[model samples]
Target: MAHSQTEEESDKMGQFDWFGSIGATPEAVRVLNDQPILFTILLIVLVAIILQCVLLWYIHYATLKPEQKVKKEKKKPAKK
Candidate 1:
């Protein structure tokens, strides 16, 4: 069956087309439709920042020494 021009164009949409559908703001949708590569790079940088923060936290926690318990002296019963 022959597809309409609009249908053919829609079929050629990039993988990021779904981003324009899920409650994105009009401006965001415009960017996604017009500059998909910029949107993809922005997402990559955002994810990299989040991952770097997580890795730094993991390293900070992993190298920490456990606290040593302090022994308290027991007081003798009161003298008669």
Candidate 2:
């Protein structure tokens, strides 16, 4: 029996071939893709900023100024 090469295997190898690249290796690409630590850190940072903005907006526009309201009430009685 003789070994035969198939067109599909040849195409797959060609697709994955990065034979003449400079600076970056397959190991580096594999390591970068496999690790999720950097992604997780970025996600946490984004969530924190979003939460901070939400809290800031709540404090800016949602809270009532009880002291100012009381002062207006006092002045209104004196004016009448």
Candidate 3:
């Protein structure tokens, strides 16, 4: 006689499908192998740094400069 499906098998399938007929192909392993994690992280960090530097420069240049201060001349009153 055939046995009914076990709860463990159903639970495992619910969590992760080892034999699911329909699912997206796993890409993490291939992506990791194709591009080294360290290099990818470093590249992202470098891009962030460059973008930050460019942003800082853009903000620094975009700010309005202080207006030229006008000096007023004071006239001395004639002494009696």
Top model by lDDT, which number?
Answer: 1
Q: Which digits, one per residue and each the tens of the lDDT, describe model 2 over residues 1-80?
A: 64455555334433223431555565554444456475578689999999999999888765768654434434555564
Report every candidate's CA lDDT: 0.76, 0.58, 0.57
When summed lDDT is taken over every stretch of 10 residues in candidate 1, the lowest stretch is: 62-71
By TM-score, who's the top model here?
1
Ranking by lDDT: 1, 2, 3
Q: Write the per-residue lDDT of candidate 3 for residues 1-80, one digit (tens) a residue.
A: 65555654344332223313355243433344445675579789999999999999888766847553345779999899
Candidate number that wins on lDDT, 2 or 3: 2
Position 8, candidate 2: lDDT: 50
Range of the 10 consecutive residues with the lowest summed lDDT in candidate 2: 11-20
lDDT of 1 by residue, 59-79 (tens): 887777765334588999999
What TM-score goes with each of the models?
0.50, 0.39, 0.38
Name the regions of candidate 1 deviating beyond 4 angstroms: 1-17, 68-80
